[model samples]
Target chain A: MKRILIINPNSSEEMTRDIQDFATLYAENEAEVVTAKIEDAPKFIETYQDEAQAAPGMTRLIQKNQKHYDGFLVACHSDPNLDLMKEISHKPVVGIGESSMHSACLLGDRFTVISATTGSIPNKEALARKYNLGKQLTSVRPLDSVTGAVDKLDLCERVSRDAIDEDGAEVIVLGCADLVGTSFELQGRIGLPVVDGIASGLSTLLGFINQALFISKVRRYGGHV
Target chain B: MKRILIINPNSSEEMTRDIQDFATLYAENEAEVVTAKIEDAPKFIETYQDEAQAAPGMTRLIQKNQKHYDGFLVACHSDPNLDLMKEISHKPVVGIGESSMHSACLLGDRFTVISATTGSIPNKEALARKYNLGKQLTSVRPLDSVTGAVDKLDLCERVSRDAIDEDGAEVIVLGCADLVGTSFELQGRIGLPVVDGIASGLSTLLGFINQALFISKVRRYGGHV
Candidate 1:
């Protein structure tokens, strides 16, 4: 099995558990995933203030565990510390936010991110710009304050239609780990691909693992030695 | 000087001369550029049928002259045989469509593509998908046939603003070789980055050349033969 590490940039054990469960449930047989939470990170990241506070904590986590993992996944939706972590780590690192955007782009001509708050829009925009995904973004819609705080099942139908009928979002990116398995309901309503970022990241990590294995095989065969 | 070849994939000698003049006028002092037109191809590419007719001719041009060029620019905005050419050529090859979309994504938080005809909208959307650029695209707008062909200057201004103001396109991509140098007026009008695909392709090619040089130097000096 290819050993991979998934780092949740926040200290929330609940969020860490969400990502861990999803990775464990979906990762291919050839893959093994481990999850870690940054002990010093903020509880919730609904704004840039939270993002800035979370970045250094993530940096420290990767710094401590860089050598043990074959590949890394930054599990936060904002992809905090992505560039800095990539510069320091020898292995391939895939950020959940970037992988979701790439996966969504692959599935459709355009997609819009539907997130929890308006405050996080700029952060989403920043992530889009950093990963060269600014062109495929259709619209960024925030769940109204009432909708964001209420039970997700109550709001699922409304969110799906708004993403498709109003914004013309051909692919729907569930930008939060909290909505992990809501794809069936939402996609049924929207009649388009509803991408779960956490799942997409795990799948992308598998591809990277295969790439690393191919490189190792080439080296063993004396092709590059 | 770095030698670059810009190939106009269609039989339009008029368009070929226009692209050659633009490259000669703007390319850096360290870069030398030459332009060639495929003598047998379509007149105007407003639909997928035109692209299908033109692609084989472009493949022939690249096959015959791939060895001498250090880098290549596909001057046609439709980018008829770009990927096939990349598969066969040793040098870095950039399609104006892909290069401009990539550059526009880097320059701004969002972009919109404006094309000359409604039939070409799907073609632009397909280009975005092929390059994995659909995520950054704000919208694809089409200029009505009468306005596009008869009112040339007015057509450019209207298309630029429609992308920026109405569609939330922070970077405007001029979608055709016929739109060359129109980015200047568009940038002035839109008050944001307006990318001329031809120029963007040239800039990206220069970057590829520099990277190749650096890799060559590293292989020679940092390793044993």
Candidate 2:
């Protein structure tokens, strides 16, 4: 069986657990899932500074255990240090953010991303364009949370409903790592395909393994072995 | 079982047969595969004029059999008159081109489209950008065909190798309907993920069916219903 290591680039143990559970369920005996979090990293990767701070810790963990895992998945929606991970590890690497976006296009004609902060909205849009994915992304709607963190399923449901009714979003992508299992219930309520990053990323990585599809070492990632 | 109608806009009955056999195998008894080709249409959809010529016939086919199929798949990589079909048919409609591009994002980072003629290359590139799909489209390379058609798997193998070595294409998409079932053998020869639209599009359609994911009728497609 292929082994997938999910590196959650945050200090939140609860978030790590949530990511792990969802990935394990998604793998469904097809692959083994190993999840970890950077204890010294920030509680949440909401800012560019947070992503920068979490990079070194994730690099160390990946370098130490790269051989044990067949594939590597960066669990945060921002995909902190994803290029570094891909360059260093010869195995296939995918970010939860990219995975969710790619899966969104497959699920529907147009999709909206529900993110934790409005600050993240631009970054989410830019990331998709940069990767040349999420061409069908209609909008990235921010959850109007008082705490400015991903906290409630009710809020995701409401925001997703708006995205559907207002943004012409046929699919809803939960753009925070903390919102892993909320997709199932949210989709049921909305009557549309609602996807989260962790499950989507894991499934994409598994598909890569199933087909013997690996990262191209031709030019962009040729710096590594 | 969910029934998917593959509308081959081209008049090539042999190409339609190839699509049917492959989609049935990929569906794996999960969905019923029904295939049709417009006999009055052009033999190949290599030019914009051909796409325009075939639009009326495909539109009539979808209109007549709209309720008979669970999802509708336009069988050419160019995805001729796709928006029109979606506007007319309320059920999910996907172009094989759109499906291949979305699936490529899942399989690899960078992909190259191996088209039959040099003339169709620009159209393929534009379609991906228009759909906001295939952000990682490294290049669209043409087969050096004397007949200016999709023929000979050997030519596909050679061009795919060049795409990987020269263009950094980790995945090779056989960007023509006639190239169905050619991916497996091509991947074996090149040691990379080689994908075709017919199977890729069918699997994506099935994923939509599995999730009960339908098109957004709130705004852009709201004119019909």
Candidate 3:
């Protein structure tokens, strides 16, 4: 079976557990999933500074586990240090933010990302621009809560409704890794396609491994070998 | 190694050869790429009616080969009978148009499809809407040549330039399967990301097989055992 290492850039044990549980459930039969947390990193990555600080820890985790894992998934929606990880590791490395947004593009035309807090808006927008999805991205709406609280579902629903009715969004992307497994439920409530970045990341990574597809050394990851 | 059957939905022997050569070269040492053509299909499918006429032959090919191939790639960028094939086949089935469009979304933001002729413009537009990419799709510009003539590259370059300038298109998708393997050359001249649907289809299909990811029967293909 393929071994997949899911790295949560933040230091939150709760978030790491949530991601591990979700990955285990989905890939139970086909692949072995191992989830790790960056112990020294910030508990919540809501700002660019937090992401920057967390990068080294995430990078260390990837470097240590690169030989053991068949693939690496940067579970954080912002995908901190993804390019660096891909450059250093010979194995396939996938980012939740990139996979989720790309999957959203396939599911619908206009997609809005539901982030954890207002502070995350800029990072999300920057990611959209990095992927050249500025036009397809309808908006990046925040839920204003860092914790993945059940109570926030109502607020998320309200924001999602607005995105659909007002912003003309046909798809909703759960921009936080903590929001894994909530997509199917939210899709039912919101009456639109909902995407979970964790799931998308895992799925995309699995595809890369199954197909023996890797980041082209000559193209995307040059000069690193 | 995985076996991938690339079904050219058109009858043109030359087009089949082109697809076979491209798939074989790219997927070498990883997957066995097989290309087959529908002998009764039109030499060129520029309209919905032509696509319709070709469906039965393509369907028959899928039914006969479903048991042998590990995955199926509908070679036509129009992805005729895609839903039906997915419903009936147990193995993973991918459409070139869908794969290419999804890959383009990841490579860049907004994209324009370059078609074989003006007659294909309406069909391409309809596909963009079906994929919910009406906004992300800048336009479907034709090479204005049905014969796959090399002279049309200049026209393609000019139209692609206009798409970048006027439509702000960051990626260009070769809408026809015959345009496979030309993206790299075109990207150099156009100074933007260019996508070949054939390569995208094979890559995506390999991902599906590697990950064991499939269109959930409970969701996409209900009641079909």
**Among these predicted structures, which one has the highest DockQ?**
2
Q: Model 3: which residue pairs collide? A: A109-B132, A132-B109, A207-B207, A210-B210
| Candidate 2 docking class | acceptable
Model 3 misplaced regions, further than 4 Å: A145-150, B1-8, B11-40, B43-74, B78-94, B98-101, B104-225
- lDDT for each residue of candidate 1 in A1-225, tens digit (9 for 90 to 100): 678888887778988888788778766454688988878768767766777788787777667777787888888777776656655655667677876775565345467887767878888987777676777777777666444437674565576566666766667787776666676567665555577777766655554443221111111112223
Rank by DockQ, highest first: 2, 3, 1
* B153: Cα error in model 1, Å: 3.1
Best by lDDT: 2
Q: Please tell me which model should have the higher lDDT, number 2 or number 3.
A: 2
Q: For residues B10-40, what per-residue lDDT tens digits would candidate 1 score against the true structure?
A: 7887888888888887675647999988776
> lDDT tens string, model 2, A119-178?
888888888777665457789988864444354877887788778778888878889998
Output DockQ, candidate 3. 0.12
TM-score of each: 0.51, 0.81, 0.64
* Predicted candidate 3 versus true structure: per-residue lDDT over B157-177, tens digit per residue: 877877777877767888999
Give me the displacement of residue A115 in model 2, in angstroms.
0.9
Give each candidate's interface RMSD in Å: 21.5, 3.3, 7.3
CA lDDT of each prediction against the hidden true structure:
0.68, 0.79, 0.78
